[model samples]
Target: MHRHRGVAALAAAVVLWASFALTIRGIGASGLTPVDAAFLRFVTPVLLLAPWLPRALRAVRRERPGVVVALCLAGLPHFLLSALGGRLTTAALVGLLLPGSVPLFVAVILAVTRGERVRGRRLIALTAIVLGIAATAVLTTAGATTTGIGVLLAAGFVWAVYTIGLGRTRLDLISVVLVICTPAALVAAVLEVTGALPVNLTSAPVSHLALFVVLQGVGTGIFSTLSYGYAVRRLGSGIPAVIGAISPVLTTVLAVPLFGEPITAGVLVALALVVGGVITYNVKPRDRAGSALAGPPPAAGHRPHVRGLQPHLTTGVVEHPAAAGQLHLQ
Candidate 1:
């Protein structure tokens, strides 16, 4: 039953994740800058989850300062990079490159830092992901720029760091949400007040504002975070991760009609390779002893050891906020 719930939650979160890519790309029509959209994204969660701030702060104090900083990097900075990259490139590339590159970056980070070996299927998965990203950047003529590809790839690496840092902390769902959103909201507010980041919140069309507030704020900010985390807890990171790999494809398909983005042969090839690689990476092989060795489903919030990259789940369903930013590829 719990696994069923997790699958449902994860499916919903993937849809929201795709919507994030769409909305970020659609911001120009709404008269909101990337910064403005990010402000709404960060601030909404901070205000709605304000009651958990104190506890989250206390937890932060107990954590290594680096982990907290990593969490913050994954919030606003990641969002801005993604938003900018989406603007410079097609929404299809934004969806494909951002999340698709995460596991590859995670594997590289782990291999370099922790000496975790990537052999067997893991190696093949990473290879496929690399080829996919390369093909998209080099072959796709679907309005993608070199600068945009670089920015989204950078965003992927940052989220990879956040995923690693999240595994090192013990903050629960609400606390994780607060810890990431609070500082981001404050920074955005400062930028807005100082005239560094433009604000169209007051004059933007009501319908546009409503769209962003609901999709970016409520859906991506709150619901995706909670649902993805819940899915990880109940299903163990592997299943949800594999299913979540579909976001890029979904986003690409939606972009066709919504943004009139063209789907070329290069885009389709890139999607096939990246999605296949992501699913391959997330799948855990059974041991020689098979189901007997596989033991029962872990209790809620228990982290199961799945080979390759998996997002670290904290207590409760609120792990990392990357899900909200469209990189739920974690």
Candidate 2:
């Protein structure tokens, strides 16, 4: 049941992302400033990743400057924008703008850059998904100002680019993460040294600070990524990527009980649009003969053909710190 396994992996990713919404909320409530909170998320992760730095060093050196720079943008800046934006707005907005809209961005990027054709059903699916995102924006709380939406959209753009950048880099997950984070950590270290970060960030409740470190560092940073990549391998990245559109719906529903938020008709409608759109996108078209995804398994010795399937970011789970291949997307 490879399909079932893929479903389970995507389900696990959804759960982790739902937790991520709450954790960003906790950071906002704490005494930590945006920069301070960004630093806090990276602190333990930097330390945890220190010993493995040497493994990534060579790749860091040899990789083209432009790719490394793009990775760096996707690394700390992406998190800083989203984490800070999460603080500035509702977690619902954070979930809605980032993960919810990424698939559309991926499709646009593939079409524009690779000359990949989007036709028939895919176009309709993309249209519904875009409408769904628009509906979420319409549900915006009075508290969700222009700035907050801008921040969330910024986060979404960077993450979409990050996913695109993945195809360009040859580095495995862990090494790329290391290369990405090392420069960012250095920048944060400079900020801390310059007294730009809060002087008493440690004074924020130790329990809460520890919560941020553990969840951001270990849970979201490591485990969720591994699971998402696993699903990509099992189902091919296309299915899981489309399935990930449901993350916003899942986060909003779970938040009703966890954060005491109320449900609304808009969210329900958005959920329906997204789910229907994703399912429609995956269906094989009947009118088109020799459809790309409709063929049987290839003969032995022939590499299987796929249309629009994303390359796996990493082969398998990281067995150790030295091998902790990149597990991103959260």
Candidate 3:
């Protein structure tokens, strides 16, 4: 039952994430700047989750300073980069590069920081993902588009660091969400009030404002993070990560009609490679003990043990610092 709930939550998160790409790409038509969109994104959750602020603050004091910094980097800064990149390029590319490149960046970070080895299929999958990203970059014609890709790649790297840091922290889902969103919302509010960033929330068309408030504020800001975190807690990181590979395809297909973005052959090839690589990378490998280690597949009602995580048998939820941190929607 818990696993089923996790799958449902993960599916919802994937759709929400695709809509995020669409909304960011459509910010221009809505008469909102990236800053305006980002403000809406950051502030809504902070307000709705206000009750958890004290807990989040307590967690921050206990967490490593670097982990807090990583969470902040993945907040407003990541959103701005993603928004700018979405504006400069197609929504298809925004979907493609942001999530597509994350695993590769995570792998590199792990290798450099921890000297982790990537052997077998995982190495091959990373290589395929890298080639796909390179192909997408090489096929771009416009300078602005190229720059957008670079920015999105940088955003992916920042998010990867956040993913690692999340795994290291012991904060619960609500605390983690508050920790990331509160500071970003405060900073954005100050910027808007001080005339540093443009303010259009009051003057933009009601329809546009409503759309952003619902989609960016409620959907991406709150539900996406909460749902994804819950899904990770129930389902573990591997299944949800593999299932998330569908976002690029879903976003690209939706964009064709919504934004009239053309799907080129090159984009198709790149998407296939990236999606395929992500799936391959998440496949569980056989144990060294061969057939005995392989063992039988879990029964229909059996909950698989998530490697590296301690399960809370009473609650049936996996507790890990990284579970809630696996979110990559930004």
TM-score top scorer? 1
Report the alpha-carbon TM-score of model 3 versus the true structure.
0.85
Clashing residue pairs in all predictions, respectively, total: 0, 3, 1
lDDT of 1 by residue, 1-330 (tens): 876796898888888888887887787777888777878888888889888788778877887888778777667877888877888888888787777787788788988988888889978988998999889778845455878898888878877777776666666656766777788788888887776877776678888878888887888777877677677666655566667778888889999999999999989999999888877876777777563212343355522122222342210013222332222232
Identify the runs in model 3 with alpha carbons over 4 angstroms from their true place: 1-4, 232-237, 286-330
Model 1 lDDT-worst window of ten: 312-321
Local error of candidate 2 at residue 324 (angstroms): 24
RMSD of each candidate?
3.9, 6.3, 6.1
Assess every candidate by TM-score: 0.88, 0.77, 0.85
Whose TM-score is higher: candidate 1's or candidate 2's? 1
Give candidate 2's error at residue 150 in angstroms.
Answer: 2.5
lDDT of 2 at 224: 62
lDDT of 1 at 187: 88
